[model samples]
Target chain A: MSETPLLAVHDLVKHFPLGGGVLSKARAWVRAVDGVSFNVKRGESFGLVGESGCGKTTLGRLILQLIDPTGGSLEFEGQDYTKLSRADMRFMRQRMQIIFQDPYSSLDPRMKVDSIITEPLRATRRVSRAKRREVAVELLERVGLQAVDLDKYPHEFSGGQRQRIGIARALCVRPELIVADEPVSALDVSIQAQIINMMEDLKEDFNLSYIFISHDLSVVEHICDRIAVMYLGAIFELAPTESFSVAPRHPYTRSLLMAVPQPDPHARAKPLSLEGDVPSPIDPPPGCTFHPRCQHTFERCRKERPALVEVTPNHYVACWLHQKGGGKGEPLCE
Target chain B: MEKLLEIDNLSVQFHTPEGVARAVDGVGFDLHRGEILGLVGESGCGKTVTALSILRLISSPPGRIRADRILFEGRNLLDLDAEDLRQIRGQEISMIFQEPLTSLNPVLPIGRQVAEPLMVHRGVTKREAYEEAALWLDHVKIPAARERLNDYPHQLSGGMRQRVMIAMAVVCRPKLLIADEPTTALDVTIQSQILYLILKLKEELGMSVLLITHNLGVVAQMASRVAIMYAGEVVEEAGVMDIFDRPFHPYTQGLLKAMPRLGDRVGRRAGRLNGIAGTVPPLTKVMPGCKFADRCPHMFTLCKEKPPGLFALSDGQHARCWLKDYPERRKAHV
Candidate 1:
């Protein structure tokens, strides 16, 4: 991997205004993704994990240019994606694709597997039917779907199979990068492994970079090279898979790690359940978004929002409790 | 050590347009008092159906509890009338659903939603029920229960709504709780909080819980005993440690291997996900052979010919597989 990032997100912010009326011209804004920054290297998998409604999906969409961010800059392959025209963006989208969470709803019910896979090709340009069919077949085979399955619709196949078709469609344009938003979360556990394995193989085969967005820590740990743990609207921790899983630095990240039910029976219980509900995004609390629920929260935490500072070589954490004031807090960071 | 509930030959079938789908086929299990019995399975494996059956909540038009006996506290739940079933539902066997929003009445206030069961089942006055609702709400750690009491379901976050649901379910002081994928919808951080709250509530009330989830890790953490279901039948049943440590069934082994755990990543080849081949068979397609035979690597002619019944492996371990029946002839060992 090179020093230059393949995809860079800087100060990304997406806010949705809620409950506006004529009388009240402006209502409060729900900070879906607020002041988030991250970068994905070429051929690398960067995971974005958060609870539902934490704006992980919104962030992914922002990166893919599906949803326009209220603020921020997205540079993909060193190109300013946010500045691209509609037509230019359409062409640029050929190099980027997305796989949604629900396979059943994501795919068209009326369209056959072949058409669904080749839709990207069809939209891009006028190609010969035979040539399109050939490309579609190649993609289907690449995703482990048989040629005989071309005639069947999405509803005919199982959840995992449909997801494979979705993958095939994403691969139709030969995208260099793919954004998978909870792709395997809807599938069965046994089937989730198959999808993850297939993604890893495809990444190697196509030399693709993946922005894998999911809530499952175990799944993320299995396949992701680097993971970013998002809370409310901001990233609390970002580290390599092993580091994030073994010795998470952020209090929220640590709590998340301990929360994952380990198969080992002898593993001591250190469950640090965060104290309260995720504060409302519409009217979020001042300072650290996690401080209200954090166990290690102190006076500094409630008043000051910590910046994402590197605690180790690559591990980044945003928590006042981990700040270098050397307050009476126990140092869990190694 | 007292048995709170025992289900015997509980076969639940759903009459769909496709066919009469056997959701739960002759399922039997015992829920001892103050124990957490984890019912583990993939989607469409009837784990949720079994839980719904226990509460007599299966929708009759499509669902039929055929050829089974559900005994709760020595009383046959199957024999109970509509009124009696309704009375027993939240009072003795409350269910916490997978999606709190869908389960909760969106139009009603959080307090009203929580207090409805108390008012309906226990015949508490409006004021008394509201008081109980606020108390239980506080018990579940929903901060500012008084202020949030009048808030609608949509006002609360996923975790908060789930807590509200839990509060409502336990407000009746139910002897048994059926949590159907309660934490699956939430993130790991929030999920831990919910798990912690449930465990605390269970201890305080001395309630036995039937936890339905596909995540084996969760089962290992919470369950004293586990029943591994596949295609509407419990293929393996044993202590949590026994199942995780020495799984007797091929399907159970497959599930364990398929999970890409943090621990399993070490010393393992990259891009190697242990996924079982072939998808789960549709429940409508009844077969004489083992339901998992098509996906089983060690499947033989005998396995494809006849469905293996539960064979006792040890004092408390049982497995339904032909390989278990003939240990000497076992091939393709996990």
Candidate 2:
């Protein structure tokens, strides 16, 4: 079960500099992914969840090496893949694919399904034309698409069908880890279930590990083995899905859980616990990024940033309320 | 309770190059004073069209709107003259869209845009309108509302921009508020805040709301009654509790089952999600039967032969299905 973990991320940091000219110095940096660390295990689905601008997407991109990190290391298969050179990383990328949120824009409108699926194989593997066609048809059929659909353009298919094509393309590379960034958020409820079910089945058939990034906690709770709740570009809580749903330690995590309205009409009768919008990333809060909106915030929360620490066996939280000296899961910190 | 808004047999069609696409067909609903009526559907299901049709917002060349009557406060909106409709559009009825950025006047300062309605409708002076706008912004809980008046729409975050949109839409204190997926664009935590804000404002102003969205959870949280739409028709209309606890229509049941509920531990890996097979029937063709017939698990010969009428069930629930028409067919529904 513990074969060096599928992917290990350590203290990752990516700060995008705001607009500046050659004459003027960079005024400030938007801390997109700041000092985040996590691990994805073999054949496991890891979820990254947060609000918009919390940098869940940025973290996904960094982990996939679509973008470079400003600091820290990314270890894949027990090797420091972050240090890999351009060509080496290109080869490494063949093993880690990404499925985008918007199926409309992700696929080239002009390109047919055949080309879209086979393009990755052509770029990486030395496969014959006949072999590529065979693989394309086989993968298309596997993803519940008819072989006839291989010749159709992206626009011909509906949102769910387009997503299937996107999946086929990701599987075309035969990657071990797939980064699905809000893959089903764009689809309807019925279609969302279809795609999520298919992905679950694919995970089993292909022996794949997934880094599922979404703001939807329900989907995350359903699909992920473990989850990391990000707020303002940092993980405030990391726990196994079971532990996460039952005993969420972070104040922000509790607020997020409370905010998600259930389908039952009886649910969510109370007022919203969290207050205010996420502060600007350009200059996030001075102490805990979530302190301003957090209900349990106190003196320590306003002044000192909390690090992710294991208060329970598996549940890790970044809040003074759960700290050792502050007393475990008790009253608000002094 | 008195009915604030009554829509009867409302239909919207688009004259595309290929054929006439009926986006909404025979949609009817009632919104009582100070009540929230949720209109929920997937993409292309015409929930948005129904909301827009109330204000006659559809442009006539490619789009055409038709209805038996759209009564708001005892006046038929369909019979109103252009000038009369204009007077009633933002004053008697107001609407906020999914994308607030495009809806907002990007070039104008937030204060001026928010105050524009006050000057036009209430005939307040510029200074007076601006002061009132600031107060409205504060009502929506925008931080530093007075100081942020000088800022443009681009300056605010997504949540902030949505708040600005809300401030502008309800600043005149309209009798009816049509929010088409108001919180769909915002994050989870912010979504609850916005929903809470909408609820608060509705209570304070004694306004009826027509909330349109694809999310059942949000509908369950906000709406007192819900109307499920599919293929341009209202498939099911019931109290929120009835819709959640016992959905009569097959489509409504499918939507509820398909949604991944928070804290539902039923997700063991590769676990099948009860997704409704087949996609939403395209509006390109006018089929002569139940739109959901192809996807319904309990499909019968009658379902394909004739479109079912809305059968009035006990406890104020109505469902458009052959299953509801015959007790024998209904036995298969459960």
Candidate 3:
């Protein structure tokens, strides 16, 4: 394989205009994905994690071009494909697919398992009906389902089985990149484990890249090679899972990690020192979006927006505290 | 510790179109005053159904609840009439749900919603209720509580709406709080804040909390004792440490192993996650043996023939598994 990343998103932005009259311009803009940048290498599972309305979903949708981006670019195989024509974009979409959070709604109630799984195949290319069924059965078995399930409706299956079918549908087109948005969030813990492990194995089997989007920290850390923490439609910290979960540098990341109820009863989380909900995206706090909720915020944090800078090897954070001559976060070596 | 609420042989059945769904079957647990007992299970495992049964929240005709005894402060709640139960509902015990938005009245301002319990239970004047509501909201860490009191449910963010829910649940100073996945809908950071608030209020007010959730992390942090339910039965009951470190039930062990822990990042790939092989059996079907037998790795002749009663392992720990009958025999496999 070449050195080029399978998917590279640079300074991506998506702003939803709101509350405008028929003739008037948009009164306000919801900054859903603001200047986001990341790369998913071939056969890599890159995780994008954030709370609700933090724009993680928007960012994922933007990557698949499921929605139009306000600015920035999506590069596939070192090629800027955003400038491609409609017909060309359809061809590009064949290489990328998305697995949604809601399996119950994502799958059509009227459609049988065969039609649901083979929908992508039918849409993307002209395949024989018998061949589609063959491919569907193969994918179903691969995803831990049986041939009999191909005739059943979604309601007949359990949540876990439905999720497996969802995975099968996502892989039916033989996509190089799969954008899995909270793929396991809707399922049970036991089922979540099964889906995550299967996804990991499938990544190796298909040699595919995944932009795994979820609000779940432990799952993200477990499954992804690289993790990016998003807050208020911006990346606060990005690093490998080993360093990210164990030793988070960014205050937002640390706070998020602290919030997770550790499985061990011996360790109890300290009371949250921070205050207030995330600021309105329509009119976000000036300078740093996180300054209002960060305990370590200073005058500079309120006046100057920090850029993503490397704090350690493979560890990057967009926080003033990590900047030179900034407030205490970590002691720098001479 | 004195028992605040004691449930004995609780069972709930929903008369669905298909058949009788035994949602909660012969389940029992105890919650002492000034303590949190986490009732945990995946979706459809009857943890939520068990909790709802405590308050007689199940509707008639379609739903029916039967219990040998649901004693609260030495009184049998099962015997209480609608009028009598109404008096005890918010004054002695209150419950919070997963989705605060759906639970809260969308048209009503948050202040009124939070203050309603105080007015209904305590017979306090509207003025006094509003005043107390504002204070409680502030206590839950909602910024500018007085200003937010006028905001409708739609106007407030998810975290803020949950704060409103908490304020309402605790404003009456109920001796027992049935928190049904209270923070499940909020972000991780907001979840921590809510948990901290619950702990602090539980400390100050000396309240017993029956915390129901699927997340083990939440149980670890909040619950002193835990009851693991599967397929409408309590598979395991133990202290938090016992559940995590010395679990005896195969189902419990499988769940813990299935979970992707924050500390499991290293050497994760070396071992595949041990997810339970099958989905929880449908409630409509009547299984003669142990409900978890189908998925149990250590299923024996006895487990498939007859259900195992709660086998006492230690003073407070028990497991509903046939292997518990012969600990020595079970030890041989491990």
Candidate 4:
């Protein structure tokens, strides 16, 4: 725990071009991941949760240098990765692999399971042909897949089995930091638990650190030690899993917890439904991005942006309602 | 206490290259007027299929429905031909899906999309339909609905698109509305907005709702009653509070135990979630016993010998499990 952060991101930003032109241009930038900062401690599972277009997945890709950041500083194991040369970044990537959301699309249908896993070992120059096969089989076994499954294609397997193959490939290079972007979202719910359990066991066995990204809070709550709730490319709340879930400071976080359908009959009577749509990312609202839909929004919220300040000793939140002098939680406006 | 919708001995099958996949089998339930019934299960547990079957929307030869009856407003929808079904589809019963993007027409404006249902089902004139559409949009809490009428589906945010979907579904004031994972695709804040909109509309129209979803948190917040399904069957059905407080079926117990909630001190102390092991069995395979037997912790020989029928419990609670058959094994509480 005392070891330096395995990955530290400072002011990370990613903006996609929204429109095009030849002579004159009418364009806007979709601010996917904007000015976000976080640190993933070694061997710790840090979760990044937001809605579909909230930029969590983009941030994961940016961290692994899979895509270039619009702006940010990235340091991996004290080594500045943002400034790394193309070849250096490529070599460094072997130590920081990623598992995508859709295992069906992520795996090459043309290739066999053995070849898929061996591909990483080959790319990293980590093993010879004979050893790669042996290692691939072992990796498959590690992810609860059988050695015989190595000969099958991605489409040949079921969704759960395909996800296991995807996991086996990610583990082939023995990456210290794995960016698993909604790895279980595509699988069946029953299978989601199995994979999450396997990932937890694998983390302990391999001493791995993960930047797990997802919108499903329940799954994230089960796997992550710490969680960062993001909105419109920026972090709204970051805290320990237990604390964040119980007494969420951010209005958005509270609304999120309230939004999840609990199985209890009593819970359904008075749902705290959020008020409005999220403003477009192409031109996110000024000040607080969430202010537009926030129940506790004030005139101050619309005019001034809040900083991610420490609310508790460890918990951080970026909302005017939770300002040091303001208050602790969202109170209904009279 | 009249039933708004009644499903009897419902079953659905899809023919694939491998074999005939029996999706939903012998599912029966009743939705009281203005009541919100949550149909919950993991993926492939037939929750969505059950909803689709109620609408008689299962695609042709490859897909077949063997339901004894789907009574809506005292009419057996199973016996209705295409024309009769079409008339009732949006007028008597409406449906909303997980992804609003796919459900909406990309080429059409928001106003047109909303108006389509009004014109089709209610036979309103174009101008009248447009006016009605604007009002419905405003009803769903889309600000400046008149000005935003011309905007295409892509122009609005995810939450707005979902609102449009809801507005269209309820435009004709259907007696029963089926929302299949409506908010699962949106962010938590947006999800809340949509759920809130649905709740408001249900109250206003006095329409019953059947919400099909894998998210238990949503069921707790939205459902008045819950039907917990597993591998083509309803394992448990109870009042929402009873399902949460005194879950009788082992599958229901596992699903509850697996979820991570706010202020879950016991969950954190345990460190590991109660993960259900193994993937859902393929629908093509015929099982002689309880579908969840392989995953159940308290499985006995009887569990594997024959599937249990729905056993009545106090307070309208019911569950299908061999454990329930033995009076001694029935615990007084969850």
Candidate 5:
């Protein structure tokens, strides 16, 4: 692998304004994604994992520039993407693509399968109509579809087949980096494995890099090389996939891992219970967002927020426990 | 163990324009008193249809449900009148659906919606029902339950709404609780919390539970015994430990192997997940032989010729495969 990342995101921030009217000014902003940074290396799969309303999806969109970030810098292949103009961004679309979560709603019902796969090339006018049709046929076959399915609409296919079409569409332009946001969450368990295996095969065949976003830790652990665990709106742990699974640093990460129910019935259920629900992103807690639910919290966590620091060679954690002489000074509990 | 509910030769079919779809094909199962029976299957495998059939909830214009007997507490539910069924639905058997937002009434307050079951079934006053509802919400671990009573369904978060749904389901103190993918829509932390709440309530109330889910992990954790469904048939029925330790059916083995575990990537490079070879056959495409024969790696000519019946194994475990009937063939193959 190369030292230079295929895509780099730095200090990304996205805030949605709430409760603004003609007579009243804007009250506050919902900090959906706040100061998140990560990188996707060439031919590697990077994962973003978190619970619902934790801004993982928002971070994925920020990288794709689907919705403009309030503040951030995105670099792709040594060029700044956030600084690109409208025309230049349109041209950049061919190199970066997205496969959405829900296959049922992502595809158009009126359009044929062939047209859906070749829409990117059609929009950009990069290829002739005859050539686009030929490319679509090839992509359909590559995704385990037949030529007979080219003329059928999305409604004619099942959930797994529809997801295959979604993948074929994403691969139509031969993008270097693909952002797959919860791609197999909607499918059944067996079908999810099928899609994940197909994705791994395609990545190796095409030499593609991916930014996979999902809430399932096991699925992410199976595919990603590096994983980042997000909380309310910020990342608290980042490490290699093996390290993250075997020796998670952050309390939130450990809790999440213990919370997962294993398939083995003989395995004992560990009671690493959190106190309450996730705090609202609109009115986040004062200091550390996870302090309310964290069991190893201290008085310092209520007054000061910790920054992400390298605890080991490649493992980073944003918790007071890893700080130098941090948790040792405080008492065991409140 | 005493039998709480018994379903014998239950079949459900839908008369669509395309063809007659056999959703559930002669399914049979028994639930013991105060036990949790998990029905595990993928979508279109008839788990949901089987649950809905227990309460006679299927819409009957295009749907038809037939059964030899659906015995509950010495009374056949299939032979009950509408008034009797209505009286038994909320008072003796209640159901919690997958999506709480849609299952709840959007126009009414959460408190009133939860109290409705109590008022209708127990003939309690509105004020008394409301007071009990508040207590129920608090029992489900909802904070400030009394104050949050007047809030509408849309106002509460997904996790809160699910808690409200649980309160509603248990308000009347039913003998059986049918939770169909109850925690599927929630996050991992919230999902564990909900499962724990259900377990706690089940023990306190001593009620039998029918847990319907596609997730093997949830089944392994919550159910004492499980029934594995495939293509509208129960292919394997066994104790949860036996199912995990020694899955006899090919479909069950494929499902367990296909799932990616948490620490599976600790010392190995990322590789393709083991997936089933083919997609599930459509419901309309009925065949006389085993529905899984096409995808089964151990399929023989007998599997394509005739469907196998349940063969008993040790510890009351059963699997529907010809290999169990003819042990010599299995030895020859090995």
Candidate 6:
């Protein structure tokens, strides 16, 4: 809605060094987030979806600056966050928060709900101790938890309730952008809906944006306005939610959509003809990272890398099939 | 079709420091020969407990399992001695767990693990068992199965490890297979592959399967019939199509509506997702009424007064709801 996006990441790259010791030097780098670019508009829910080793989680961490990026620019609210000082970054973090996937490990088991919720406020010293407690109670209520639950420990609560605490903690800072990294994946189906609905309500109430990272397409489709389909480390496709679901251009996206098992038993189970598992990110295949498993592979696809190009108004795809003269033969999808 | 397994009035309780938790409360189901019966429910819904109870896997002192009958192929498994149960477990009935890594032996070679069941049950030589194991691994679509056989559990990827687990489970050619969230830990693509593999194996081997999962989509795809569980009770049981097309129980309806479908993104923008209002009731507390009453959207006075029995809807369809008794009231509410 606004001219400047809430969060803008340009060519972000994070490479984890593999096999570093006295005997062996860093042999190689696992390109966790290699040259990824995206922008999250204010009040928008942007989804990052991929398989296990696609580095979607790593990308989320990189955005939050939980881990340092190997290279790229991170601008939040038009300010270059990568260039910000330590104190400035810490202050900036108040505007950006994260909700983890696993509620069991995310929350401090020993700490009370009130202390956990108010930890962010305590770190910044932005409010009085009494005020912080009040904030925690209010935040707890906001997340559909009772004030009485403040005294209870993490172990006392269920998975869904613990996730609510995590949400309450994230909202304690009143962040403009929240990186929810597979927030509902660990939750049961029924509980997952509750959390997703709660998140939607909270987003509306706080006018917050989210970088929703998940492998579940259905959840991503429900919560996200726009989605980016990530591969080994790079985004293969980016499109609006409706367009992506209705007419996905990339073979990977199409395959993913087909792969999701529908809740209707009458619906036919389409055989997923996608060959082999996701290739190792450490030793990624040449050309398109998805080419090895992709059904529409050609001579050109095996030889050159494809750049992300806008095929339609808002739909972007990185595939040789879309580019003119890129495919050796006839393109698979029109 | 012949009934391969029949569970009648099965109950499992765990005595913890807090209280006696009724993990599985009078749950019953029938698995016909060569048919896949999906036990569908969320976490703590006792789906896994029901699966474990079938094999007498629940540890005693803390856990106590009671059943009128647990007839597997005309033999009451509950009446079987330790030695008889041991003989039946891997040979007649086998189970594959959610986490393949932990379920598998970390130190032992994958080949040995897969072959162990055959060697123990069939009294086959180690060399013959290993050869058969390689064939089963190849059947599950594990590439270069012979070479991967020597690798430890840690050596293979998550998807590969799950494939190995599947191979081991099917190597014995058991009469019944209990897959408790077999593909839960794998990615969507790999999950599709595994599900198809299981389907193929079921067809080829003609073995009855009790598929336990929290995912409704998986049930729709894999099972011929479905049993929807809530608070340790099977609230609804019907043919897969019947359950999906016209879910009778409020809990079943809630679970269905709660799922985020790919094409159902319209309501996401204009309206909030249709999620169940409250969290699952704690198993420690014993209530006289329906377990789902606390979270049921259509709760009436009768729902709290007494627990409902299974009301037969059709030949095979059944739902536990008071609304079925008072048809006029149910119609009026609708």
* Native contacts retained, all candidates in order: 0.66, 0.79, 0.83, 0.59, 0.76, 0.76
User: Which should have the higher TM-score, number 1 or number 2?
Assistant: 2
Candidate 2 residue lDDT tens string, A225-281: 899999989999999998888778788888899888878788655877787788889
TM-score, one value per model? 0.94, 0.96, 0.96, 0.91, 0.97, 0.97
Please tell me which model should have the higher TM-score, number 1 or number 5: 5
Per-residue C-alpha lDDT of model 6 across residues A1-334, encoded as one tens digit per residue: 4599888999999999998987878989999988999888989999999999899999999888888999999999788888777888888889999999999999999999999999988876578888998999899999999999999999998899999999999999899999999999988877898899889989989999999999999999888999999999999999999888878999999899899988878786777997678888898998888889888888877878899988888899999898767755544456
For model 3 chain A, the run of ten residues with the poorest summed lDDT: A325-334
lDDT of 4 by residue, A137-224 (tens): 8998988888998898888788888888888888888889999999998876667777888899999898899999999887788788
lDDT of 6 at B231: 89
Worst 10 residues of 1 chain B by lDDT: B262-271
Worst lDDT window (10 residues) for model 5 chain B? B325-334
TM-score of 3: 0.96
Pull out the clashing pairs in model 5: none
| Candidate 2: Cα lDDT at A158 | 95
lDDT of 3 by residue, A76-167 (tens): 99999888888788888889999999989989999999999999889879999999999999999999999999999999988788988998
Q: Model 6: runs farther than 4 Å from truth?
A: A21-24, A329-333, B266-270, B331-334
What local distance difference test score does each model get? 0.87, 0.89, 0.88, 0.85, 0.90, 0.90
Q: For candidate 6, please provide the TM-score of chain A on its own.
A: 0.97
Count backbone overlaps in model 1.
0
What is candidate 4's lDDT per residue for B200-314, written digit by digit as tens?
8889999999999888878888888999999899999999888888889989988887765645542445355666776678899889999988988777788888989999988
Tens-digit lDDT track of model 1 for B13-63: 998999989999988888899999999999999999888878777888878
Query: Residues B32-68, candidate 2, lDDT per residue (tens digit)?
Result: 9988999999999999988888899999978998899
